[model samples]
Target: MSEWDAEFEVESESDEDPDFGPHGDARIDHAVASGTFTLDGQTFDVENNIWVVGDDAECVVIDAPHDVTEILEVIANRRVIAILCTHGHDDHVRYAPDLGLATDARVLLHPDDLPVWRLTHRAPPSGSLHDHQVIPIADVDLRVIHTPGHTPGSVCFYAEEFPGYPAGVVFTGDTLFEGGPGATGRSFSDHDQILESIRTKLLTLPDATVVKTGHGPDTTIGAERDNV
Candidate 1:
């Protein structure tokens, strides 16, 4: 049932990293949305993970894939401060504009991925996301880490420390995944560059740094360091 077809498949929401419960200091929520991903004249079905980070009052939604309703449902009544796209891939940013419209929140994407972004959306991004930039959520912040190769502007959001929450977590799009980096064989993607990006940017984080990905289950930097 957790698929993104016309049905807008809805799965039972999963809790944040077990340690970071809904009421826990981490204050994160997660959902999976499905839809077809189209690019370079080809399209395939995909299921993407949607990350919501905030407290009782407000929050930020990450990777607005398939369903805006689902995203909003997860957001509940909290004020949506922003919609952050890890990259400009259609699946990740597809529902961003819809979500922004529904919540009156700005949608942010790195400038470099505009070309890919335009393949799906005509209007430019609501705002730009840049390297080392700090995105303030309720209390903690996500420091941008520009890790291209999945797309020229692919980036990750690293949340190091916030009161009451565990330190060291990164939100990686398709640049890196559980086993290793995802498909670079696609158009506009690179193999070596992504590996290098992972090497210098992500792997350098602490071993316990949790890697919140754009698709599938969560992973850790330490679990991926030796494998990738």
Candidate 2:
């Protein structure tokens, strides 16, 4: 049986799932560790995950929420190495500079969303993030997949062996979700593009690949596939 049976009071497969814990934890090992914070008047469950593959300790932040103070409170103790933006929404990027200032970590983002970054008037620790670009932080190697659905610069970070699933996991941001996927409503975002990105970038991962989204709860490629 899946880990769902261990922690959750899931009655049946038909029962509605609340919170992203089950799928989220399945992707992140209990030892992996995570932190939560609120942003944009909304609460974002930010996960401060550490990886072991390099000399120094490295971490990856799923979404840069608007509530910098809360996020700071979340990972106050851990050493952050990198910041990953699920998409270039105002709420998500609002705290990028604040977090960057606090952690001194490199900010990773797609070139297409540079406009959103520019609005902040802050330069990323590194530079623009590209599709399929593999960046190394502390001890983590994050593979960037430009999943532009919510925005043109949306991307997901994938790391192998850091979480429960041996094959690794993917951070869906706003592009993909537990049941179906996120909507593409921005003026610049193309509905067709977002759909295509999921089909190619996210769903292409192994069935066991867990999806950690920007908002709401978490789901897996396998679990969502069955529903889709």
* Model 1 misplacement above 4 A: 1-26, 162-165
Candidate 2: tens digits of C-alpha lDDT, residues 1-228: 224332223432322223211111222321123344433355545543322222222345655665566665555565664666766665566667777878876565666887656654466424455666564444335577888766788888776655345667777777777777676554557788888888877777888877776655667887876543
> Tens digits of per-residue lDDT for model 1 on 87-117?
9889999889989999988787888899989
**Reference-based lDDT, residue 157, model 1:** 89
Candidate 1, residue 220: Cα displacement in angstroms equals 0.7
Clashing pairs in 2: 39-67
Every model's TM-score: 0.86, 0.68
lDDT assessment of candidate 2: 0.59
In candidate 2 the C-alpha lDDT for residue 154 amounts to 85
Clashing residue pairs in candidate 1 (N, C-alpha, C atoms within 3 angstroms):
4-34
The CA root-mean-square deviation of candidate 1, after full C-alpha superposition on the true structure, stands at: 10.0
